[model samples]
Target: MTQLVGSLPPRWILRDPYAHQKGIPRFPRVVATVLAARGITTRPQAEAFYRPHLLPEYDPLLLPGMPEALRRVERAIEQRETIALFGDFDVDGVTSIAILHEGLAPLGAATIPYIPDRFSEGYGLNLGAIRTLADAGATLLITADCGISSVTEVAYANELGLDVIILDHHTVPEVLPPALAAINPKRIDSPYPFDELAACGVAYRFLQVLYEHLGRAFDDTAFIDLAALGTVVDVAPLIDENRRIVTRGLEAMRAGLRPGLQALARVSGVAPERFTAETLGFALGPRMNAAGRLAHANLALQLLLAPTAAAAATLAEQLNALNRERQRQTEEATALAEELLGPEDAPLLFVASEHISPGIVGLVASRLAERRNRPAVVLSRGPEESRASARSVPGFDIVVAIRKEKALLVRHGGHRSAAGFTVRNENLELLRDRLIATAAEQLGCQPAARVIEVDAQASLADLDGLEIKGLMAFEPTGHGNRKPVLLSRGVELREARPVGADRSHLRLTLRDGRVTWRGIAFRQAEADLDARVDIVYSLQRDLRGDGVELEVLDIAPAAAARPLEIRTG
Candidate 1:
């Protein structure tokens, strides 16, 4: 047994006896215990968390100007007006466009889909694109995943006699865009109870309201799959309504109704029979995202909407190629960004290069934030304007921080954790200074670095098949729900050796008395293990043909003594 580096806070384990006695199932004692630790003790609350309702119970009109938006959509439906969907190039944007298109297409309304080139057009509504759509006889313009911050572009569209309806979920700027109807939950005047919906979620709700207004009977399940794909890929919280959407979406995906999704699953080596959240987030999301990051996002969008098996297969192969190219580009850009840092003492990292794709700056920013444990902003210099992406630690809202420096940015918007902006080359320094100063004032100090949290304490003897089965119950872990990491103390490292081609993996053994378990730590061959140590790990069956072994997340030296103290709440 090994003691892990981190321990669960005592407050998380101690629970109220009264709540436990109120008939909570303890068979999944750890589940109940953890839930109680998180302050969820009642049956109803647990049910809500574990099994979320996919259908919206809140009034759709609660969304800011949603009623007005519905009116416009209903009019377009009745008149058979040519409506154009303007969307971003990412997964959320693509899925939003598809959902709206699917929702309106069957209503005998003419709908056109348009995606801006990330390199040429940048993000959000552009005057050139709007004019082009107008030229194509589109009278009504609906935007998804974007347009919340396109104040000027929306005004331009309105000036051109184009009726614009905005459906978006991003940080609301101080001044609202001048669209005919702006449907956003983040608007300060919004009556919507929850403000955490993703872009696709907002689009779904908008369609739901429009369908209701039109008295159209549409199958809500048809869009759940797309909703789930977008929610999971966008990294939205898998709680509340999002949980319901993803849960049902995963079920639908497993059933293999959509040829495109099935083709993706086949090519990506994800068995439909064994689909889970991990498959969505890890296996599929990246592949789809790769298209946007490296090449045309239309490839991924086409794959998702492909009607025929042969078409899906062809698109899947194309997407696979794009993903490979994305990997190569990401590696190169990440290396360059790291080298650019070169021991800077700045509280924030602002790195820019002309070679990096603007579509992937956000991804690079995320990696930098993880490696440096600071807010990271990455930019790609465009000919006319420079585009940037920002990612931040907890407690620091990058979008809000960027908004505070709006004078230095030409355009900017995003969520609390991540954001994107564009600025002129001359204003880069000013933007950086303003963002740093704002962060210092708002955060007070650098946010605490992310720390590993152990779900339960374990010993080497507990690393059994039954324990592994128990862990499986916590499926589909992500932003809100995470995989449990257990810490074991005083683990005897019987042997250790390098395994990978680059000698980055460590294959070792942990033994306590007669109980011994084989363990492998990826990219941890360099870690020091001269003495007995604690290991934070997840138990996994290796299934390497002959047999299976366990995997270790991290192995660090055990504390000098066990800090043992227990108290009941």
Candidate 2:
């Protein structure tokens, strides 16, 4: 019988040394490996990456409909029109809402922000909501983070004598919406240089262009900070303009110019100076997303718009409480999912239940996919239709698999790793079987072993405080650019003991030759005990004011360390 957990070894792909090559600007070996792995080839490219800058000009305005969108918005601003900002119910949507609300305030427009209910309205635009916005004295409706696929809804808005402007970043549908202007970089006719901007990113750029169109001087310092939050929370690739946005945004955030972010950091126990991509990914983003997942995203948007520190702190506390509930819901849903699909080796894992929260099914799929090392779809079933969120492994595209079953789905769309769909209760079983066969065909007969790519090989002696600090230049890590993973060979463990409340984490003092370093491995209680072992880890500054420490990714006995097969997408 196979054990509940598989024991396949991880594949390590270390980058070859490139700093020694002629014409390449020389950096430390480990830093060079990180750059090389990220494909930073030229000297200018390295310099630009080392000191990334916010773009000085507009690139998003190049999208096909952006010019017209700006013109409509400028006319609305001149007329002091009542504009409604429709947003989704997530961190990205909330942040985008805040940015556009602030962006339009100085332009003499009365902006009303509307975040659809996750349970009631589902994902995108609904006709009833459109009527509600119009009744609220909104003559113009602009959608952020959603509305790219709202074809019939836009036509209805037009019929109601409301001009619609869409600021979205999702994959464009076969037929575009009938909005006055739909600005999506992914549109088939879009000429935007970059197509991966998060919804708030698109909103921020639109503000920049709108200012330009009105002949106004725009200082983008604060709007970019909001955009950075959405970009990081959306897990958009940290490249091109995203790199510029986050890199500079962190600096602006530390300045505490934005009252909401400052208060959020204070209540979240994060020092402004220490905020980074990792901080957003783990601490702040979850709290911002928690309200959207559990109760209402308005609470989060309120935090951003909080007028004073006291108000922001109060809202932050509320959001923090909501986040705790979201965590509990996620844990319950994941346990239920695991129980339903016990000890199975299916290519794709599918689970539908009333136990999962509609807002958290995507998170459940992510958690299951990471654990099972296979594509997972978790559905929160409703009476007439079931909403399913799917997450995929590194190689297989879950969105493509979902597309194959389009005939059975009401609607579905997402990127390669993640997607969602609404299917009737009756079609759920057929959807599962279709995906199983699709997974078998797209992925080979047998799934490849899970792989962990090492970024470089370094000795304990090589990882000084300065080396670790130098590597910190690789800030704002996510999606395309991740924190570097380095391997240290044959390190003897001087002391090892279980840590953390559940005793699932390992705290270690490791020695290699005469050099010693502290290390911690989260949830590594099952690690094999060995006198000497090769450990793959990432470097971080020691919180105790010590030099540096290692965050172990994986550990194996020196003798047992061997290569695993590489599977490419």
Candidate 3:
């Protein structure tokens, strides 16, 4: 039997009973409990949570630097100054550039969208790219998704007589770059109620303010699609204003996908009517990001900016090929990284390799962090320098930890959960030691036991009336919002067999009373289980799309001699 996390079984934490109090609309006990778990106990809260259209619009000007950013943009437009849209080489950056270009171009602003090559320029605002944009007669440079920490690059731009405006959402450093306007909701002085907007969301908000300043109504339908794409791809929390953006954006997408996205959807084999947040996150986002991860991000930008369906189709096919290659490369790199990992139970998982692609180090780090339930750092080592990407488990602030050792780093910036830094090869080991010690003080030396938060406990028969429509009302579930998980106890495991290409998954037939449910547990083929089990799972549409199936999260022996303890909070 493969022990869960080597020794510790996953702790089951049941939802707090206080959230189940009255005031919420009458729903199935399971559904109501799930809503309460999410703090939607009020009628209005439920409405806004379920139907994002009901949420009130937040004022775009609430951001700290909004007024200054608006002024600079207005001045550039009035003077017909060419503005360069420099963005990061990811979905968030690509979509940010696309949104700004589409919004500003119609208002008589000459915008040139530029995404630096991931392989050559690395990340953020590079001096060479800044010099190139300046030489191209661009008097104004608007950096999307990045540039929050480019003090040196911004200074260079200023020397070339070009004003810079930053639209980003990364964690802000104590000393910000000297840009004309640094508009980011994460700024310490920001008054914005929600600070989790993706870079494209910030760009969209900027456009809203710009259009209002020009005495024109902002057409959200024109650009919300791109904003939503970036938000999901960047893993921004799906709450508050972000929820509204994705909800409306999804409606817009189903009504009509842009020519570029339409082509991508076709190539991805998803019908427009079937497009959901999952499609964006799982299908479209990966394909779009593949270009930046394995090749030049300009390919993705071209697909988004394709004027005709034919042009979009060609570009979409290329991105599809790139995505496949990216998957292969990531798999190979992850396997190599696992081999290099010193110990599975280390406080922090840090591995450096010349085999890992710098562009995919973040993805590799994310995988290791999830698998080990610890903070993970993956570095792509070059001759003299190494670029590292780190992913942290909940409760750990990776960027904050990395910031403490900035003396040895050339440049570093990112959010609490994810961060990246460039460091000299000689200091790599010392930096790793410092980070591991910091993580150990916080996370302990051993891997913490994984915990599964159960929204409700139910029998298989109780879910017979659970309509797929009602369950699916929880659309756009990711990051901050997650699909509800249910615990079904004392179920008979009638049949279990390995499935999938490598037989790495378990296909299960479970029964409680007279009701039977089919379930699939991924990567659990070797899990030794009792004939009867208590399973924690989420309900989802089966591959056939006609009925529901259990996507099991965890399982334990049924009716143990001593009933398994369930912790309630």
Q: Indicate which candidate wins on TM-score.
A: 3
Total backbone clashes of candidate 2, pairs 3 or more residues apart or in separate chains:
0
Off by over 4 Å in 3: 1-8, 22-25, 464-469, 559-569
Poorest stretch of ten by lDDT in candidate 1 = 3-12
Give the Å error, residue 183, model 3. 0.9
Worst 10 residues of 2 by lDDT: 15-24
lDDT by residue (tens digit), candidate 2, 156-236: 998988999999887777788898888888887877778888999999998988887888889888588889988998888
The per-residue C-alpha lDDT of model 1 at residue 398 equals: 84
Candidate 3 lDDT tens digits, 285-327 = 9999999988899999999889999999999999999999998
Per-model TM-score on C-alpha atoms: 0.88, 0.95, 0.96
lDDT of 1 by residue, 1-569 (tens): 22211122111122233333443575355445445544566887776766676344787788878877877877887888899999988889999988988888877779989988887788889989999998998989999999988989999888878888888888888888898888888888887888878889988878877777877786878898898888888888776777777888887877765878888888788777677677777778888888777777888888878989999999888888888888788878988988887655356779989988887898899888876667889999877679999998766888878887888888888888889999999988888887777766765543333445555565766555544555654555567666655667888888899998779899988787688789899878877685587777765545342344667876766754434223333
Q: lDDT: which is higher, 1 or 3?
A: 3
Which regions of candidate 1 are displaced past 4 Å?
1-27, 54-56, 442-449, 458-471, 492-501, 507-522, 530-532, 538-551, 559-569
lDDT of 1 at 416: 87
Instruction: Determine the C-alpha RMSD for candidate 3 after optimal superposition of all C-alphas.
Output: 2.2
